[model samples]
Target: MSAWPDSSSIPASETAVANKSEGKSTDEKPSKGNREQIQVNPKVFNGETQIEVDGITVDLRNRYLAALLAWLVPGAGHFYQGRHTKGTLFVISVLSIWMLGFALGGFHVVYASWYPGDKRWHYVLQAGVGSAALPALVQGNRMRLATDERGRTRSDYEPLWNGFMAPPHRPVLESEADEVAAWYARRGSGYEMGTWYTMIAGLLNFLVVYDAFGGPLAVPISGRKKRKSDSSASSSDTGEASAFADAV
Candidate 1:
């Protein structure tokens, strides 16, 4: 047999030309594993661009849980969201402040007194009264912040506030509290109603607290919604950059 020259014997330019002429593709398809690699670009916000983590998306997983948790215990919602330290701190702060106020502010007397006028005035005064209301308010505000949807706090969305704004002359609890206090002062039936009102307020507080911190995680309704890229979507949104693209 005649000796054949090895490929190395060919000139580099000739080899490249030969490879190209043979229908060889320079752009090889990546392997399956390699195809999994994703490159996200930096997010743009208000004319500023910042990099962030590549894979994480907005997770509305436990909104109800957060609310429920907050209702059950002051900062439970935060704790449920993998923020144990924050949750505990919130609970401690709200509860401590409320409790301390009650201990010092004669809350029990306010609640137990039967004068309708006294009860009404007491509620207004005790707006700073119970540890319950403040914590509930805190939890509700937290839920509003933590929740993904924007219109959740709209009073129109709530049945309790439907058709009840200024000029409607709706019977607000404050007015009722005053009525109850006056009624009791006059030895009328307002006493029981005032007590019941207080109880209902407490219960409402519980629910709000639970929802704020311990409500069930609300799953994203759509695949796209699940993939939110807003700056508020992640804990690391501020003060960091990453090699990822966010399409928000």
Candidate 2:
């Protein structure tokens, strides 16, 4: 018998190492995995977009719906998001301005119409207060000439709901100057002031709506200044070149 071990008795692994064979490995290294052993807490995300402003945390939930809610009723989105402080403030500020404007203009400054001479272009801006301004559309439609079920045509400028938000009489039907004079005689400067006030409310609501859709501005009020001052102080302690040193 031969003194050396039989070739059939040698394991393939030892044989490959001994011969340095260029063969595929079998279970030499750990298997590749796509998962991590550690994970972040799921609560951190929780489907809400949160922003910090002035030490306050604002969680905006479903921002698109919040925006639409804010537009329909100023601050409603904030209310939905549980930001009561902001919601109350927005409701008070926006509605107050709108109400004051409506009162000043004899509650008739927000009518919608595209007629010449009294084009009512201001209504475009006023409509930013979504639901509040939508009534004008209804009133305008009511004021338009329509036939009854009896086949009798109603007169133009006819109004229902007590003419609330109805478009003013067609200025071109008579004279633009005459219509202006009539309004001036009725409410003097109140109409103009009210128009501007209501429009301002609408614009402000637009901003609130945006705030609902997107969190507050990311600009830090004091953080940047504080950091800059700290850096400057550190640099000074290190005797680094500064504007004064350059000047000298």
Candidate 3:
């Protein structure tokens, strides 16, 4: 056996083993900067926490108020969100449609009179346009006050429905009731058409309200299509090259 080496002169095998162990410890131990970097929340990488519009920061955390405002007045929510052009367009178009219907059939067209024999579903649709359609409720109340318990018009309010109802004429023959029925049918047709126009306007405004609350529709990305075209071109080129080689 050789004399034992001094502590300073350790065996080459032991020295190599010590060096390898030291290298592993240095490599495996993370630096302070890297440790801090890895501690970040993963959700932070997903998307933005706030949206900036027209130099104003909007916290998208609560949009219920905007939706309510939109319901109260068409395009108002868009205006609140800084979308002036869309809001103005929606207000103009929706109001114009509503006004046109009102002009066609007069105040009688918008009344929200819903009784057992007078259930008007069109009024429900018209109410979606907001305050512009609320006058109908007042008109309805007046009509209600002018009617008797039997649903017949009071003598005082008879003139009010003159344009809407058949003319008051004494029947000389048994067939006179048919003539009155025909007259009512003609008036009913016109009122139905006007109600349709106003209801459609309200429906359109309802869609606008949703748009205002949700913000503008997003433009679709075309990057994926471009990548697909590039890949297809590359594959075609490879196929052609192989074919040419075979031909050669």
Candidate 4:
């Protein structure tokens, strides 16, 4: 045998076989190439997909229903529209403040010389009546617009009520009526203030409603672009196979 593998070089268990094979016929001998190993790259698998969602539109009918209900009753709109807590609170707050003002101001307005039975008391009475009713009416009108079924605003109705179809003109002040009318005029100021206050209050309520129900029709979401794969990296399968052989 010419330079056959030594006992220490070949494993001890294989030494016996190597010596035996060294002296055997070439056709029956096993070559070193038979013991050589090969490795293959491993592959990574990912499971991901892209999808979309349909858009949602606003519901005008529901808004209108809330507004209408509120108009009919002090806070009925909120209540009917599934806002019972706010509706109840608003109705109670307005009514309580108004009634308290009346009670404190006296069932009758106190003036210089006129008694409760005097005609002068009529001015004060009218003032009280207006103060209580004006705010409610103003709020009702605003609520109607705020919660419109068609999502229409107050400006839509302004053309009809504030323009050509407006209510009849105010009565002219005659010369003789000025003195007594002045007192009533002052009294009318109370309703004016009430109207303004109610307008503000109603607007605030509208804001609250907007906060509760406001949202855009819908927004589109785009899918992420695919990333480019690296061309130089070895196969993950080869790594896995080598790891498995090492483990074994």
Which of 1 and 2 is ahead in lDDT? 2
Per residue, candidate 1 scores C-alpha lDDT tens digits across 162-230 of 211101111214555542344346544444444444444444445445434322223222222324554
- TM-score leader: 2
lDDT of 2 by residue, 1-248 (tens): 89999999999879778655656555466566632233332433455477543233456778889999999999999888877768889999999999999999888889987655567789999998889999899876664445354433355546767877877654334443554466667998999999999999999999999888876554443343224446546544444422212111
Off by over 4 Å in 1: 1-60, 107-115, 121-248
* TM-scores of the models, in the order given: 0.30, 0.63, 0.52, 0.28
Worst-scoring 10-residue span by lDDT in model 4: 41-50
Evaluated with lDDT, which candidate comes out highest? Answer: 2
RMSD (Cα, Å) for all candidates, in order, is 19.4, 15.0, 16.6, 26.2
Q: Which candidate, 3 or 4, has the higher TM-score? A: 3
TM-score of 4: 0.28
User: Candidate 1: minimum summed lDDT over ten consecutive residues — where?
Assistant: 163-172
Write one digit per residue (lDDT tens) for candidate 3, span 1-248. Answer: 66886867887678768879777444477777655322222322344433422222333233566666777788777666655666678788888888787666543566666554456677889988888876667656666677677655566753334433222222213354543355345566665667788899999988977665544322212212124446556555665544432111
